[model samples]
Target: MGLKAFIGKLYAGIAQKQIENMRKNGIGLQNKTFQYLVNEATATVFGIDHGFANIKTYEDFKARVPIRDYEELRPYIDRIMRGDDDVLWPGQPAYLAKTSGTTSGVKYIPISKQSMPEHITAARNALLNYAYETGNTSALDGKMIFLQGSPEMHEVSNIPVGRLSGIVAHHVPIYLQGNRMPTYKTNCIEDWEEKVEAIVDETIKQDMRLISGIPPWCQMYFDRLSAKTGGKKIKDIFPNFKLFVYGGVNYEPYRARIEESIGFAIDTIETYPASEGFIAFQNSQKDKSLLLLVDAGMFYEFIPAEEFFNDKPTRISLKDVELNKNYALILNTSAGLWGYNLGDTIKFVSKNPYKILVTGRIKHYISAFGEHVIGEEVEHALMKIAAEEGLDVVEFTVAPQVNAPAGQLPYHEWFIEFGKAPADLKAFSQKVDKVLQIKNIYYADLIEGNILQPLIVKVLKKNAFVDYMRAEGKLGGQNKVPRLSNDRKIADQLTEYILN
Candidate 1:
């Protein structure tokens, strides 16, 4: 075997063994991991203050450290940024990953030496797991283009502040860097447009075997490639392109357009990697579920989504999680975040193997007028309808339009940017409304009681969200249009670009 293929097989074997060990040990290993983390962090100020040394049980840890969001953890992160040692982790973080925040603006997430390797390892294992499942070692032979964020790192109190992708890109193994496309200089181009064009120019003639990126950005890359290569599909340009690895957004809506761009079906792997930590990855080619990274240096807890908004919610461990129940994720990582609510929700598909599907973000929902709707419900409805109608939906967002003036009632408004529109717009709106009503009883009750009007659908000009995101300085890399809003904020903004 070639060097790349040999390395691929070796890594795959290692990854598969780790996955199997995780599955077999599962809860016992998780508890031990938690105890280890607690012991390691006991010397830190935050840990010592919380009595981490005396906390031998999960219950004691939970009682000592209350669940918190990024806002609550910001002060400790700020202390770390100011070169404080052992404020949260055992020492100062190596970098501060700047993630987008809602009202708080930029959120600086700490990345210590302990946690950075975990991120890198998780990313590597994702590919290795894919190789193990598919037995396609040839993927490592050709170039793998990771359409990622700008590598321009800014100094935040002597620590780096930049996108997670860029941070990880710098840490890409020297061996794999040989087969990775778009040189570091090209990736450092801060302007996404310039980066995309430069990447196309640099790698158009190379042998590309794998493409890994967020679906929206990947679509843009594929579109540019197709356009540049005389209307040829991605496969036509790079016939050996065998794998598409994606995360950051639901791939369902983008799947039709992605396949069209590729001109054929290909293998895919999904991942649930966040700046907080790399959480899960699709391990089996046969199942669409993702195996939870139980051994990945992070302790996990789940709060039932139904009770998440309550004054006191039940928090359960990985062993206590049930199949097919929506739960908000809470994480305690070696990176110094204790009981940090990642703000994302997920449901377990298989407990034995510990597979999960990301449901939605905690605050990403529309509950205005008591017609509660989550991102997962809206995405599923839209994906199903778009498939049935043979339409290609690129992106979409929903918000409540509460002030209907004097006599009219409030209704949900959907702003969609479609690659291909439905034949009947009115019928499309009706179908979407029906699905939401069926999924959410509160919404159905409102409609039946004549308290709310039927949902409204407005097709926006193509790239409307792209334009909005650009104006907001959030054009690429992990920044996505919020799927649902409680108010008319996003809807009103999109109305400016609506096609009528």
Candidate 2:
């Protein structure tokens, strides 16, 4: 066998062992995992203060610790930043994964030394499981390129800070360094445009067998590659490319553009990693859902999305979650976050092996008129419309047009920047409205009751969304266009940028 094939077989074996262990334990292992976390964390300040030593059951643990978001944990993180050990976990985190915030400027999530191995292992298993399940391991033959944030780490109160992607890149196995592209020097360039140019120069001619990145940025890279090489598609440049691993945002809308650029069908794997920790990843080529990383150094809980904003919410363990219900994910990780709300919504597609689909962000939606619409629903509707109309959507956002001058009703406004505009723009807008109406009963009722006008569609000037993100300081690397907003905050901003 070739070296790549040998490596693929090795990875398959490792992933199989992990999968078998989970299958052997089943739901019973969740309780054991929770117990193990509690025991390991009992010595920390959070654990002691939360009465972790006395907790014996999931119910007991839930009753002691309340569900919290980053704001609630900021004080503890601040203490950790000041060089305090055992504030949240056993010792200080190896680094803080700095993430862009919606309203807040930034968020610093701790990445503990105790938890780094778990993070690394979860990533490895994702690739290996895909190889084993599909028997398509040629991806291991050549270099795998990842488009990530700059690796230049900054310091916050004497603690290192950088993007999660950069932190993970630092931990890439030594054996695989020869097979990963874009040298560390190139990865450290702070300017995104410069870095993209550098990456194109560094890997354009390499045997790039695998490519992984968020879909929108990946689209940007493909565009640059095609432009520089004078190629019709990415396949013309890198014929050996086999897999496209993506996450952080919905890929449905970008799928057509990416495939067209590739000039052929290639396998795709979706992952659900966040600043808090890696959560889940695609484990089978046949399945659309992701298997939860149950064995990783994290304990999971779910709060029904409906009750999430209530005065008091219900938290359900993995065994209690029902299929098809939207739930806000809660995590108590080895990295020291406990009962933390990651703010993303998810729905389970399978319960046997516990596979889930990310629905949307809990804070991202349009609910100004009691006609609630989440990101997932919006993306799905747009994807359907684009497919039928042969359009290529580059980026888009939706907001409630709440303030009408006079003699008009409120409605939802869609701002879209298309790579390929439709032949009949009016018909495309009508189809988009129709699909959304079918998907959301609340929205349909609002239209039926004459409480909302037919949705307004605004075909944005080219690069409008990109310009907006650039002005907002969130131009690249896991930052995404806010899919749905309750108010016209983002829509107004995009309007201003387009005018400029």
Instruction: Provide TM-scores for the models.
Output: 0.97, 0.96
User: Which digits, one per residue and each the tens of the lDDT, describe model 1 over residues 1-500?
Assistant: 56888888998998889889888888987998899889999999898889998898999988999999988888888788787888988867888888888766888888889889989888888899888877888988889899988778989667788889889988999888899988989988877777889999988999999999989888889988889988999998999999999998878878999999998878999988888889999887888788899988899999999899898899989989999889999999988899999989999998887899998888888888766688989998888888989999989999888887789898888999999999899999999888878888898999999989988889999889889999877776777888888877778888999997
Best candidate, lDDT-wise?
A: 1
Error of 1 at 186 (Å): 0.8
TM-score of 1: 0.97
Model 2 CA deviation exceeding 4 Å by range: 155-158, 497-500
Clashing pairs in 2: none
lDDT values of the candidates? 0.88, 0.85
Which is the leading candidate under TM-score?
A: 1
Total clashes for model 2 = 0
